[model samples]
Target: DYHLLGGGDSKEVYVGWNHVQQIEIAWNQIVYYEDDEKLFTEEATLLKSLNHERIIKCCHYWFDSESKILNTITELFSSGSLKKYIHNGVGVDLVSIKNWGRQILQGLCFLHSQSPKIIHRDIKCDNVFVASDGKQFGLAVCIMDGDFVKEKEPKCTPEFMAPMCLLEMVTGEYPYMKCSNQMHIFKKVYTGVKPVSLGNVKDYRVRDIIEKCILPMSVRPSAEELLKDPFFLYNGRSSTFETCAPVDNILTSRAMNIKHLYLV
Candidate 1:
């Protein structure tokens, strides 16, 4: 039986078994304008074509004319979102951080290498999920709200942290969560002011990476370049996940949580 899962904006999610496919899938049901249904379905098609391991797989989709709803069937990620681990009050070690960072960067690389290039306007821990296999994949991607704009602009969750979401991973908190409002964060970002949480990142390498990521767009490293950085090159083994901490013990099936971004 399908069970209600958390959702954001006009979308709702449910997890249940697909009898025909004989698999568990996360169903994303999004409400769209009747006239704009084509646009939404096209976005779903794009998702279905993606084959990267770090990107969520959209099995198929269908639109209900009378209900003005678009339903997308995707592989279920039972471990939940990265946001859950960060705020779970459990400590995460550097090895876990590095792996997550590298995976996300890989996902970005694949998306950007597309014919016309695809940019996930929204990249936050909430949109990144950990699969049962222990790899994190990007979700709530591409047409986040079923709307596309020719001119690129900042369209992310109001609480989105721009430094590849690495800062939040390191500090275990969201950047600018202290800011009074969205405008306040925009003003700071426009003026090149970083969240004070940047100081909380103890590792110099992690701090340096975050700083470089937050630099002016002109000087920021491409996903490929970032992956080649020294931080991810190290081969040191860590016992963090080997010990199976509460953060790594994600065995139970959980519903996918999707948070919609507010268009800027």
Candidate 2:
């Protein structure tokens, strides 16, 4: 067995490559495309199309017959997944997390705005990769497993799940009943400890967006909804997403009662 260096998800390992004889269907796909289907090929091509300092690049892909597995040969790096970094005595540095979050959101916005929105369905720390070096200045993580899809019988993770998603699993649970505010989220992240405290928050617009993202009672924003705002923009250049959150116009009147949860 070869010891591959890497990080993992439910379908992958902490580090390394797995060989398969053919393509294993993505666990979350509603159904695999027919033999002549081009969805997978199309996505691979799209991944190849995007390149940015903060985006995770798709290195290569191949299918094996004997083992029945398809593989993506990615650019190997010394840094691991964001989860590892957080676990190894790494506190979430606000600025770094902000940069990483902005890049990812920009990627997501691009994906969602496409003909058919590509729901990351699964987004969390582990699915994000850390930059190879410290000098990158930005946390520079990218959307890993970008080509993944759901199966007829899909499985999901709970930890990073939007609560409404928890309900979709047929495990009836109560949704959050209150309107969430920014401080409410700080409490969750702080988790019983003193608040990390914000400094010069107005100076970091990228951060304000992320803080909006992790709010416990907050609902996930749609690419369309973001576009409706004069703030969030697709300027066609720059790494960080642009925003002007007219505080009154930015935060939507959704979440807490999270309506639609699962994509599949």
Candidate 3:
């Protein structure tokens, strides 16, 4: 049986067994609008065609014409989203954070490298999933029908939006969290002010990455370029077992010592 995972305005996520193997899927029940159907179909097709290690895998999809419901089967990350992972205060060392950032950037690079160039307009912590093995998985919400154009004023969570989308408005509040309204948030975004979260980040490299992502549309670094940044590099050495063994042993010994002290 499929158990409820969570839901948003458009769809619900569920976890269940795929015959013998356990799997998770997202199910969207279309309201039967012709345009909505077309858009959903297109998104399904696009998702199926996309295959990348950092991007969520869409295994299959089925549409029930009679019920007007669309079902999409995707890989389930039991560890949940990055936002939740951080909030839980689990495995959040600098190394893990950097690894997650690199993976996310790689996923973005793949999408942007596509022939038509898919822009993940909504890039936020909540949209990034974490696997048990500490890998990051990005959720892509495709923007259809020229929504990126200025006239449409695409709807997005202000906190995660790029500054160009907000017309360079600067704000002291974190993106979207402090704004009284969308227009207020828009003005703040237009002024090119850094979000409160970015301002509070103590790590220069992490802060730099966030700044690059929210730069004015014309000058923002592409995901490909961001991948090449020194922040992702690790002392020009492979992170192989031989290189990490000594450090790992030290850490393990320290942990054991702490445990023994506590027991005593």
Candidate 4:
């Protein structure tokens, strides 16, 4: 029997066991809005085409004509999402960071290596799953991600949501927390001004990589190129967990210095 897992604005997730396959699966039931049917269909098609170890596998999907729901069955991860770990106070040392970062880049490399080159617009901690080995190792699986929506007015919510959510949810503040609204976020991003969270990263190598990721798409390094970066090659490890300040503390300390400069 299917049981509720979680849900969002337009979709509800459920967990169920496939009797024939003898495996648990995540059931993503999306409500297909008539106005955005094409977009939904495109997303479904893209999901179907993806198959990689680093990527979450969508075993099957079907549209229910009567209910107007698009149902997709994907392999389930018992360990839940990466977001859970971050929120639960898991100590993220340099070694863990390198391994996780490399795995994420590997998933991105696979998507980018495709003929048309797919871009996962939304690469947040929530969308990334973790498969734990019951000890110290976890494998990351990136779902076909990105939530960029286009309309008459440029919407900056989804564009900034990933970084904002990752930091704000865990630390109670994000880089541009001083910004009052989406328009302010838009201006900050447009001017190539990065969030202060990047500077808070303890390791220089990791910080540099994070900065590179936010560079303009024209100059941003491809996932394949990022995979070869020295951070992954270097074997040296450090105890970042103990030294790094809690995200909230770091942001709060800088709060007085950060001005909500809205130049419009």
Per-model CA lDDT versus the true structure = 0.68, 0.37, 0.53, 0.57
TM-score of each: 0.84, 0.47, 0.74, 0.77
lDDT of 1 by residue, 1-264 (tens): 799776667777899798987888888787778877766666667778888888888888888889878888888878788877555654577787788889898988887787657766456776788777655565546344454443434444434534548876776556676788889988887788888878777666677888888887678888789999988777355533211112333222112111222222
Q: Least accurate stretch of 10 residues (summed lDDT) in model 1? A: 250-259
Which window of ten consecutive residues has the lowest lDDT sum in model 4? 252-261
After superposition, which runs of candidate 3 have C-alpha atoms over 4 Å from their true positions?
20-32, 136-152, 163-176, 235-264
lDDT of 2 at 220: 45
- The TM-score of candidate 1 is 0.84
lDDT of 2 by residue, 75-149 (tens): 443465454444455433334443444555565566555445444544444455556674231122222332232
**Residue 210 of candidate 2: its Cα lDDT?**
35
TM-score: model 3 vs. ground truth: 0.74
lDDT rank order = 1, 4, 3, 2
lDDT of 4 by residue, 25-136 (tens): 8887776645545555666666667788788887788778677677888888777766565655776666766676677777767866765555454455555677765223
* Tens digit of per-residue lDDT, candidate 3, span 79-168: 876655554534344465556667777887787677656656555565667787755566544322212223234455554556221111
Model 1, runs deviating above 4 Å: 135-139, 142-153, 158-161, 237-264
Comparing 1 and 3 on TM-score, the stronger one: 1
When 3 and 4 are scored with lDDT, the better candidate is 4
Candidate 4 accuracy as lDDT:
0.57
The best candidate by lDDT is: 1
